[model samples]
Target: MTSETALPTPASPLDLGETLTFERDGAIGILTLDRAAKRNALDDATITRLGEFFAAVPEGIRAVVLTTAGEHFCAGLDLSEMTDRDAVSGLHHSRRWHATMNAIAESAIPVIAVLQGAVIGGGLELASAAHLRVAEDSAYFALPEGKRGLFVGGGASVRVPRLIGLTRVQDMMLTGRSFDAVDAETIGLVNYRVPAGAGTAKARELAAAIASNSEVTNYAITQALPRIVESGRDEGYMMESLMAAVAQSSTEAKALMRDFLDGTGPKVRK
Candidate 1:
């Protein structure tokens, strides 16, 4: 194989642009949806770049935070480009979106979404892919495709149901029910709710905590836990035990245990 093919494709930060931006804060990687003039509406380039960024997170980055500029987090797809696709083109386009969503959701590093304003339609679908979501009180959630005479094609049909419930999602679609941040939290769509303009701070805090965790522990939680939850009881239990054993046997785990036993580690206190 050629040297280029033998080595993995490296991911570099894309140019600072209206569509998207990338920056790093210590061990945490920050991804920003920058098209606030359009409420950060995603076009094909933005979606593809998102997949590339998440898929090839640098080795030093332990966690990721996804946030956006302006009042809104993301408005959704760039409907201006939502024209001119035949059925086959539409299928391929939707499949590309699925691939990107999966890349983000199954990323090696845990991801936190900092959300605000209108997280509508495809925006909601994008947020659903994160491991943790910090929602500002101003944030709103909706699935308006039913009104658009369209349907979700960005892994929403699968991932959203896993985050919330099938019936609730059904209601959102059929009735065009919009959810406030509080309602989103109540229904398990978001993990944290903060005052408007504080979503990024909260997400950074969560990402720091996640980054501090043992690598194996974080990996297991981010990767294995979901699959375990979806598996049969017997299979889940087996996989759970396997993950537990692997994590406990790591060198970092041994050191952590020693610290705790020696009373040098922080104790559990509330």
Candidate 2:
């Protein structure tokens, strides 16, 4: 996790002017990129605001819905900031981006991204960080760095490859190929694809459901499942067994299991 300065005081309700908006609805923390004029292009200010918001998520929020307030979800980083710079500066710039994105990715609560329109370049990188991604029918995914004589510096090289595989990412960058929402879902890039204009609602629904789970269970899933999957078979099984035992031993888990055994909970009927 990246280092964050301690907030001087509890943050007031964010005023959504033109850059980013943060709101709390029930137990869901809603983060909307509000810079529609530039297709919500992520500039330095936007990045800083995002880092601050996620770093100090208000008390009582259990999940996050990351969405944009325009036709496009995010066009990626604002290339307008690109400039002639030394290797050290470039490395630091990339690290700053990584820090902000990592804060969102590693949030104590899970994040769900609602994607629509051009989810390209750095935009795709941001979406890849979310725990769950819901894409509208109009959504498309691409990485156009190759044609532009540039490379992804926003953690895409590490995160995107994990979601959709390295070969596919390479093909996207090399060929400027764009995948529509259905294809993205089929290829495992997106977890859900809904009709146009439904991405946000779907994401909210999923977030709400996820927020209902025991906090410990959710935390384990978000923090441990990925690592378990990457481990060797023996290691993976051991992790699963351990997590299972730990979860089952929880008071909430025991109560839920008792309810089920007593025929008072929902059954596993298809």
Whole-model lDDT per candidate: 0.86, 0.84
Give the TM-score comparing model 1 with the true structure, all chains together.
0.93
Residues 1-270 of candidate 1: C-alpha lDDT, one tens digit per residue: 332112223346454345677788999888888888899888987887787777677768999999998999888889898698888778777887877788788887999999999999889989998889999999999999999999998888999998889999999999999999999999999999999888888888988988877889989998999999999999999999999999999987888888999999767888
RMSD for each of the candidates: 3.6, 2.8
> Against the correct fold, how does model 2 do in TM-score?
0.90
lDDT of 2 at 230: 86
The TM-scores of all predictions, comma-separated, are 0.93, 0.90
Residue 259 error for model 2, in Å? 3.0
lDDT top scorer: 1
Clashing pairs in 1: none
